[model samples]
Target: MAEIIGVIEQLWRYPVKSTGGERLDSVEVDERGLAGDRLYAVRDGSGRFGSGKNTRRFRRMDGLLRLSSRLGHRLDGPELFDPLGRPVADPDAFLRAYLQRPDVALAREDAVSHLDQLPVSVLTTATLDWVRRAAPSAVVDERRFRPNILLRTPPDTPPFVEDGWFGREARGSARSGARLTFVRASERCAMTTVAQPGLPHAPEILKAIAQAHDGRLDALAEIAMPGRLGVGDTLSLV
Candidate 1:
């Protein structure tokens, strides 16, 4: 038997890694993850992917967040837009100019994965509500967390509900019948506090998470069954 926990509230796809993304009403989930998600990334001369923080595979490049991407068609790659939403004729050139690094270019992910952690990141409204209560003054938005799937739980559901979802699986109550295993809780990072176009630089967002939630929020998932997912699909735990 499966228990209904929530309805899918939002679907997000990041065509380019470390950049702002587009919201969709419905999307296809595959073995790689949400289609078009992190399919492209800005690669530097040294081959590090652009990100908000430094890592073995990523280099700190906050300028990437100022841009956004939209997937036009599956046959072609996604298009990059400037902060004002104007299309860039040469994404690679624009990245080099914007970041003042001529060696950087927009490249597709190859053998190396562009994802910071797991394939899919999930967040719940219950946890968002809890963050709001924790930091009554700071701006709290789901975009900061960059979740691929945002689930809206019942109104009375307690905060941090996703904490208990690790190792469990969610089956979509839709024709596609997508299934996902909650692999683990997603750890917090400096990326959450990085300022984007509409979002401000709020370090306190991470501070609240560390203090209240042990420096973790939401969950990372992997596709157990690949299929389509929509905003209204119900995710049931098995």
Candidate 2:
């Protein structure tokens, strides 16, 4: 049997797709997922999911934007944060300042207001290594997958293999005492290929995974219960 080794080393949540994510020391889990995960997304005037897929058409949505939770810094509350952590105007005003487009900002606000759930995504270290081995030239990181949790595991394990834990409870260290279950493996998209500052040649890495791994590279998990997760938490395969 594989032994329980370590706790979650990293925790991340992308309030908005294609933008920068927020790192947390610990978070609570619910049926949907880490609170405030993927709560809002940017859409075009046509209502299609906007992202780096059509950078030229959606250039304003390309770069990284910051986010915060509206519910008192707790994961259980709504995820509504200013990109810069400053109290700014409504979503439109803030986005207009950051993205430089009143039209785009208004569209984003409209899309976000109707969202039913947060878009919190998670990943594991094992999965990242798998991609790195397959595509040595490709740069793989949380930015590419945009996951909420980045759990560390044995060096030899494959990335996202623990996703089998979906529907099962995983208990870990005191900091990450929350219950977790594997949900699904995140699907790769063209965004993986986009080049950003401090990260170059990323698309090749994701492409390599698709060519080698049947178009899957990372996994997503849901929190069965709300709890704190931190570095050094012991992960037991219960």
Candidate 3:
């Protein structure tokens, strides 16, 4: 039997790839992911997917941008905001501020006509510990695997156990509930190898997780429904 352990504390969503993300007090989850999460992404002139993945070829996407649901909408069309919360009237202008090289800028200007959207991504503390233990030397920070939900669980549990939480709803004090379904454990990628502040040596961490888990240790969960989640939310394994 699975056990109820902890509650969610922080919730985040990155509207754009590689750029910073927006923190939320509460978020509604639908099949895709946290509402307003990854609803848009920048595309290259060729209509191919573009982001930090190809930022070098499109440097203008280097600067920070944000995405959020419009006041009366359900995340079908989110709004873009600068890191300061100011509105960005022109997408081209926003791209220009971040893209530095002329060739990359024009390529982005031509290729990235709009933002790309992805399904939601979730994470938890238990998963982090598993990664830490497996790779004691790697720096595993949240930034490496940007997720929509950051759940706080018991100290010693495995990280991706939430994947086994399918058919269970994590209930909270207010009528907020999160239905968990075990998606396949996320696969590690070069992105996990990037060095960031807090995590100076990331490759080692990725290596540890991969070694411990047979080369499959990217911790992410897919949510069936999104609702308000709080610190003390009851994790009902049913």
Q: Which candidate is the best by TM-score?
A: 1
Give the Å shift of residue 122 in candidate 2: 3.7
Which stretches of candidate 3 lie above 4 Å from their native place?
A: 52-91, 100-118, 133-137, 166-174, 196-201, 218-226
- Cα distance off (Å), candidate 2, residue 47: 5.9
lDDT of 2 by residue, 1-238 (tens): 5357445778776555556567777666666566565555655455544365553334436544334433337533234455455554575566656666555543333433322223334467877777777778776666666666677777777565755665555666655657666556666676676665456656677667778766765555555666766655666767
lDDT for model 3 comes to 0.54
* Winner by TM-score between candidate 2 and candidate 1: 1
Question: Which residue segments of model 2 deviate by more than 4 Å?
Answer: 1-6, 43-50, 53-60, 64-91, 97-101, 106-120, 163-167, 174-177
Q: Candidate 1, which segments miss by more than 4 Å at Cα?
A: none
The worst-scoring run of ten residues by lDDT in candidate 3 lies at: 101-110
Superposed Cα deviation of residue 146, candidate 3 (Å): 1.3
Q: By TM-score, how accurate is candidate 3? A: 0.67
Give the 10-residue window scoring lowest on summed lDDT in candidate 1: 70-79
1-238 per-residue lDDT for model 1 (tens digits):
8899899999999999988999999898899999889999899999999988898999998678889999955726889999888999999888888999989998888899999889999899999988888877778899999999999999899988887888999999868679999988888897888788888888888999999878999889999999999999999999
